[model samples]
Target: MIINKILNVDDYYYDVFMSISESLTGFSVNELQSTGLADIYYKHILGQIEAATFIEFLNTSKTILENSYSQDQLNNAINAEIIADPGMQDMANNIITMWYLGTWEGAYVNDLSYKEGLVWNIMHAHPPGAKQPGFKSWGVKPVNSNS
Candidate 1:
Protein backbone atom coordinates (compact mmCIF):
# COMPACT_ATOMS: atom_id res chain seq x y z
CA MET A 1 0.00 0.00 0.00
CA ILE A 2 3.02 2.24 0.47
CA ILE A 3 5.15 3.33 -2.54
CA ASN A 4 6.75 6.36 -4.27
CA LYS A 5 7.04 8.29 -7.60
CA ILE A 6 7.53 11.90 -8.86
CA LEU A 7 8.12 14.39 -11.67
CA ASN A 8 10.31 15.25 -14.70
CA VAL A 9 7.57 12.94 -15.79
CA ASP A 10 6.23 14.66 -18.87
CA ASP A 11 4.05 11.88 -20.11
CA TYR A 12 0.28 11.50 -20.51
CA TYR A 13 -0.66 11.55 -16.83
CA TYR A 14 1.61 14.21 -15.39
CA ASP A 15 -0.77 17.04 -16.24
CA VAL A 16 -3.65 15.25 -14.64
CA PHE A 17 -1.60 14.66 -11.55
CA MET A 18 -0.99 18.36 -11.11
CA SER A 19 -4.57 19.28 -11.90
CA ILE A 20 -5.98 16.83 -9.42
CA SER A 21 -3.48 17.97 -6.84
CA GLU A 22 -4.64 21.54 -7.27
CA SER A 23 -8.23 20.51 -6.74
CA LEU A 24 -7.42 18.39 -3.75
CA THR A 25 -4.98 20.76 -2.06
CA GLY A 26 -6.68 24.09 -2.80
CA PHE A 27 -3.49 25.41 -4.28
CA SER A 28 -3.24 26.83 -7.75
CA VAL A 29 -1.28 24.97 -10.40
CA ASN A 30 1.30 27.71 -10.50
CA GLU A 31 1.81 27.56 -6.76
CA LEU A 32 2.19 23.78 -6.72
CA GLN A 33 4.37 23.75 -9.83
CA SER A 34 6.54 26.53 -8.44
CA THR A 35 7.66 24.24 -5.63
CA GLY A 36 9.55 22.11 -8.18
CA LEU A 37 8.36 19.04 -6.35
CA ALA A 38 5.46 18.05 -8.60
CA ASP A 39 7.61 15.75 -10.70
CA ILE A 40 9.05 14.14 -7.63
CA TYR A 41 5.64 13.48 -6.10
CA TYR A 42 4.27 12.21 -9.41
CA LYS A 43 7.18 9.84 -9.78
CA HIS A 44 6.74 8.72 -6.20
CA ILE A 45 3.09 7.82 -6.73
CA LEU A 46 3.90 5.87 -9.88
CA GLY A 47 6.59 3.88 -8.12
CA GLN A 48 4.42 2.99 -5.13
CA ILE A 49 1.32 2.10 -7.12
CA GLU A 50 0.72 -0.19 -10.06
CA ALA A 51 0.73 1.68 -13.36
CA ALA A 52 -2.78 0.67 -14.29
CA THR A 53 -4.21 1.45 -10.90
CA PHE A 54 -2.62 4.88 -10.85
CA ILE A 55 -3.70 5.57 -14.41
CA GLU A 56 -7.28 4.55 -13.67
CA PHE A 57 -7.37 6.79 -10.62
CA LEU A 58 -6.20 9.76 -12.61
CA ASN A 59 -8.58 9.10 -15.47
CA THR A 60 -11.50 8.78 -13.11
CA SER A 61 -10.78 12.17 -11.59
CA LYS A 62 -9.80 14.02 -14.76
CA THR A 63 -13.35 15.03 -15.55
CA ILE A 64 -13.69 16.68 -12.17
CA LEU A 65 -10.80 18.91 -13.05
CA GLU A 66 -12.20 19.77 -16.47
CA ASN A 67 -15.61 20.70 -15.10
CA SER A 68 -14.49 22.38 -11.92
CA TYR A 69 -16.24 25.67 -11.11
CA SER A 70 -15.01 26.39 -7.61
CA GLN A 71 -13.62 24.64 -4.59
CA ASP A 72 -17.02 23.45 -3.48
CA GLN A 73 -17.89 22.08 -6.90
CA LEU A 74 -14.67 20.15 -7.21
CA ASN A 75 -14.84 18.96 -3.62
CA ASN A 76 -18.42 17.86 -4.03
CA ALA A 77 -17.67 16.05 -7.25
CA ILE A 78 -14.63 14.28 -5.85
CA ASN A 79 -16.37 13.42 -2.61
CA ALA A 80 -19.46 12.12 -4.34
CA GLU A 81 -17.40 9.52 -6.15
CA ILE A 82 -14.28 8.86 -4.11
CA ILE A 83 -15.95 8.85 -0.72
CA ALA A 84 -18.46 6.35 -2.02
CA ASP A 85 -15.61 3.87 -2.09
CA PRO A 86 -13.48 3.88 1.02
CA GLY A 87 -10.50 2.48 -0.83
CA MET A 88 -10.64 5.25 -3.39
CA GLN A 89 -11.00 7.80 -0.63
CA ASP A 90 -7.94 6.39 1.08
CA MET A 91 -5.94 6.83 -2.09
CA ALA A 92 -7.18 10.41 -2.30
CA ASN A 93 -6.06 11.02 1.27
CA ASN A 94 -2.69 9.48 0.49
CA ILE A 95 -2.32 11.88 -2.40
CA ILE A 96 -3.14 14.73 -0.05
CA THR A 97 -0.59 13.39 2.40
CA MET A 98 2.05 13.46 -0.30
CA TRP A 99 1.31 17.09 -0.99
CA TYR A 100 0.65 18.46 2.49
CA LEU A 101 3.38 16.60 4.33
CA GLY A 102 5.54 15.63 1.38
CA THR A 103 5.50 12.02 2.40
CA TRP A 104 3.45 9.02 1.49
CA GLU A 105 2.59 6.58 4.24
CA GLY A 106 4.70 8.38 6.82
CA ALA A 107 7.92 7.94 4.86
CA TYR A 108 10.04 10.85 3.80
CA VAL A 109 10.50 11.21 0.07
CA ASN A 110 13.45 13.65 0.10
CA ASP A 111 14.81 16.74 1.76
CA LEU A 112 13.24 18.90 -0.90
CA SER A 113 9.84 17.49 -0.03
CA TYR A 114 10.24 18.68 3.51
CA LYS A 115 11.33 22.11 2.46
CA GLU A 116 8.47 22.42 0.04
CA GLY A 117 5.67 20.77 1.98
CA LEU A 118 2.25 22.30 1.39
CA VAL A 119 1.65 22.60 5.11
CA TRP A 120 4.05 25.51 5.20
CA ASN A 121 2.30 27.04 2.25
CA ILE A 122 -1.04 26.74 3.98
CA MET A 123 0.36 28.35 7.10
CA HIS A 124 2.01 31.11 5.11
CA ALA A 125 5.27 30.27 6.78
CA HIS A 126 8.48 28.79 5.49
CA PRO A 127 9.23 25.12 6.02
CA PRO A 128 11.64 24.18 8.72
CA GLY A 129 14.98 25.31 7.26
CA ALA A 130 13.59 27.02 4.23
CA LYS A 131 13.36 30.70 3.25
CA GLN A 132 15.42 31.86 6.13
CA PRO A 133 14.06 35.15 7.36
CA GLY A 134 16.46 37.97 8.09
CA PHE A 135 17.26 39.12 11.59
CA LYS A 136 14.20 40.21 13.62
CA SER A 137 11.72 38.46 11.32
CA TRP A 138 10.02 37.12 14.38
CA GLY A 139 9.87 40.58 15.95
CA VAL A 140 7.22 41.50 13.43
CA LYS A 141 3.76 39.98 13.20
CA PRO A 142 3.49 36.83 11.08
CA VAL A 143 2.59 37.75 7.54
CA ASN A 144 -0.49 35.59 7.36
CA SER A 145 -1.25 35.35 11.02
CA ASN A 146 -4.17 37.31 12.43
CA SER A 147 -2.43 37.71 15.78
Candidate 2:
Protein backbone atom coordinates (compact mmCIF):
# COMPACT_ATOMS: atom_id res chain seq x y z
CA MET A 1 0.00 0.00 0.00
CA ILE A 2 0.96 3.67 0.13
CA ILE A 3 2.45 2.99 3.55
CA ASN A 4 5.47 1.54 1.79
CA LYS A 5 5.73 4.75 -0.16
CA ILE A 6 5.38 6.77 3.03
CA LEU A 7 7.90 4.75 5.05
CA ASN A 8 10.29 4.34 2.11
CA VAL A 9 11.29 1.01 3.65
CA ASP A 10 12.67 -1.94 1.73
CA ASP A 11 9.88 -4.20 2.87
CA TYR A 12 6.30 -4.13 1.68
CA TYR A 13 3.80 -2.11 3.67
CA TYR A 14 2.25 -5.23 5.18
CA ASP A 15 5.67 -6.55 6.13
CA VAL A 16 6.49 -3.26 7.81
CA PHE A 17 3.21 -3.43 9.70
CA MET A 18 3.99 -7.03 10.66
CA SER A 19 7.34 -5.99 12.06
CA ILE A 20 5.69 -3.26 14.09
CA SER A 21 2.97 -5.61 15.22
CA GLU A 22 5.49 -8.24 16.31
CA SER A 23 7.50 -5.68 18.21
CA LEU A 24 4.47 -4.20 19.92
CA THR A 25 2.53 -7.36 20.85
CA GLY A 26 5.12 -10.19 20.86
CA PHE A 27 3.03 -11.92 18.23
CA SER A 28 4.56 -13.28 15.03
CA VAL A 29 4.24 -11.40 11.76
CA ASN A 30 2.28 -14.25 10.26
CA GLU A 31 -0.16 -14.25 13.17
CA LEU A 32 -0.95 -10.57 12.87
CA GLN A 33 -1.26 -10.60 9.08
CA SER A 34 -3.24 -13.83 9.02
CA THR A 35 -5.65 -12.54 11.61
CA GLY A 36 -6.41 -9.51 9.41
CA LEU A 37 -4.98 -7.04 11.95
CA ALA A 38 -2.51 -5.71 9.39
CA ASP A 39 -5.26 -4.93 6.89
CA ILE A 40 -7.37 -3.35 9.61
CA TYR A 41 -4.46 -1.18 10.70
CA TYR A 42 -3.80 -0.05 7.14
CA LYS A 43 -7.42 0.88 6.66
CA HIS A 44 -7.49 2.75 9.94
CA ILE A 45 -4.44 4.74 9.00
CA LEU A 46 -5.83 5.65 5.60
CA GLY A 47 -9.37 6.40 6.70
CA GLN A 48 -9.13 7.77 10.25
CA ILE A 49 -5.64 9.06 10.86
CA GLU A 50 -4.34 12.42 9.71
CA ALA A 51 -2.12 12.17 6.63
CA ALA A 52 0.83 14.21 7.81
CA THR A 53 0.85 12.58 11.24
CA PHE A 54 0.64 9.09 9.79
CA ILE A 55 3.46 9.79 7.36
CA GLU A 56 5.59 11.11 10.20
CA PHE A 57 4.91 8.03 12.28
CA LEU A 58 5.74 5.76 9.34
CA ASN A 59 9.01 7.56 8.68
CA THR A 60 9.99 7.37 12.33
CA SER A 61 9.14 3.68 12.46
CA LYS A 62 11.08 3.07 9.27
CA THR A 63 14.16 4.66 10.69
CA ILE A 64 13.89 2.62 13.85
CA LEU A 65 13.47 -0.63 11.93
CA GLU A 66 16.34 0.18 9.63
CA ASN A 67 18.72 0.64 12.58
CA SER A 68 17.59 -2.36 14.61
CA TYR A 69 19.30 -5.66 13.84
CA SER A 70 16.96 -7.97 15.72
CA GLN A 71 13.45 -8.22 17.12
CA ASP A 72 14.59 -7.22 20.60
CA GLN A 73 16.44 -4.32 19.09
CA LEU A 74 13.29 -3.30 17.26
CA ASN A 75 11.34 -3.49 20.51
CA ASN A 76 13.95 -1.34 22.22
CA ALA A 77 13.74 1.20 19.42
CA ILE A 78 9.97 1.38 19.72
CA ASN A 79 10.25 1.88 23.47
CA ALA A 80 12.87 4.55 23.03
CA GLU A 81 11.99 8.27 22.99
CA ILE A 82 12.14 8.35 19.23
CA ILE A 83 8.70 9.81 18.63
CA ALA A 84 8.80 13.10 20.49
CA ASP A 85 5.89 14.49 18.54
CA PRO A 86 2.61 14.06 20.41
CA GLY A 87 0.63 13.52 17.24
CA MET A 88 2.97 10.81 16.00
CA GLN A 89 2.98 9.17 19.40
CA ASP A 90 -0.79 9.08 19.38
CA MET A 91 -0.78 7.48 15.93
CA ALA A 92 1.78 4.93 17.10
CA ASN A 93 -0.37 4.05 20.08
CA ASN A 94 -3.38 3.63 17.83
CA ILE A 95 -1.43 1.17 15.65
CA ILE A 96 -0.21 -0.76 18.67
CA THR A 97 -3.74 -0.97 20.10
CA MET A 98 -5.06 -2.16 16.76
CA TRP A 99 -2.61 -5.07 16.82
CA TYR A 100 -3.61 -6.08 20.33
CA LEU A 101 -7.35 -5.46 20.21
CA GLY A 102 -8.08 -5.89 16.46
CA THR A 103 -10.10 -2.70 16.45
CA TRP A 104 -9.35 0.92 15.87
CA GLU A 105 -9.60 3.39 18.72
CA GLY A 106 -12.97 5.15 19.13
CA ALA A 107 -14.82 2.32 17.40
CA TYR A 108 -18.07 1.36 19.08
CA VAL A 109 -17.95 -2.09 20.64
CA ASN A 110 -21.37 -2.91 19.26
CA ASP A 111 -20.14 -2.12 15.78
CA LEU A 112 -17.65 -4.99 15.92
CA SER A 113 -18.62 -8.58 15.33
CA TYR A 114 -17.44 -11.08 17.94
CA LYS A 115 -15.00 -13.03 15.76
CA GLU A 116 -13.47 -9.95 14.26
CA GLY A 117 -12.26 -8.67 17.63
CA LEU A 118 -8.91 -9.87 19.06
CA VAL A 119 -9.87 -9.74 22.75
CA TRP A 120 -10.48 -13.48 22.66
CA ASN A 121 -6.86 -14.03 21.65
CA ILE A 122 -5.60 -11.88 24.53
CA MET A 123 -7.96 -13.50 27.06
CA HIS A 124 -7.41 -17.06 25.76
CA ALA A 125 -11.16 -17.50 25.59
CA HIS A 126 -13.55 -18.34 22.79
CA PRO A 127 -15.41 -15.50 21.16
CA PRO A 128 -18.80 -14.97 22.72
CA GLY A 129 -21.81 -16.31 20.78
CA ALA A 130 -19.51 -18.61 18.85
CA LYS A 131 -17.64 -21.77 19.93
CA GLN A 132 -18.72 -21.31 23.54
CA PRO A 133 -17.27 -23.68 26.10
CA GLY A 134 -19.01 -27.02 26.46
CA PHE A 135 -21.78 -27.38 29.02
CA LYS A 136 -20.46 -26.98 32.60
CA SER A 137 -17.01 -26.26 31.25
CA TRP A 138 -16.82 -23.10 33.33
CA GLY A 139 -17.74 -24.95 36.52
CA VAL A 140 -14.86 -27.39 36.27
CA LYS A 141 -11.99 -27.12 38.72
CA PRO A 142 -9.92 -25.69 35.92
CA VAL A 143 -11.91 -23.38 33.72
CA ASN A 144 -9.80 -24.36 30.74
CA SER A 145 -10.31 -28.10 31.25
CA ASN A 146 -11.57 -28.51 27.73
CA SER A 147 -8.23 -27.46 26.40
| Residue-pair clashes per candidate | 13, 0
Q: State each model's CA lDDT, in order.
A: 0.80, 0.63
TM-scores for all candidates: the values are 0.83, 0.70
What is the per-residue lDDT of model 1 for residues 95-138, given as tens digits with 9 covering 90 to 100? 89888888898997898888888898778788756667678887
Off by over 4 Å in 1: 1-8, 67-72, 144-147
lDDT of 1 at 98: 84
List where candidate 2 sits over 4 angstroms from the true fold: 1-11, 82-85, 108-114, 130-147
| Residue pair clashes in candidate 2 | none
Give one digit per residue, the lDDT tens place, for model 2 in 56-114. Answer: 66677778888999877876777774446567567677766665555567662233423
Stretch of 10 with least lDDT, candidate 2: 108-117
* C-alpha RMSD between model 1 and the true structure: 4.1
Error of 2 at 90 (Å): 1.4
RMSD (Å) of each candidate, 1 decimal: 4.1, 4.5
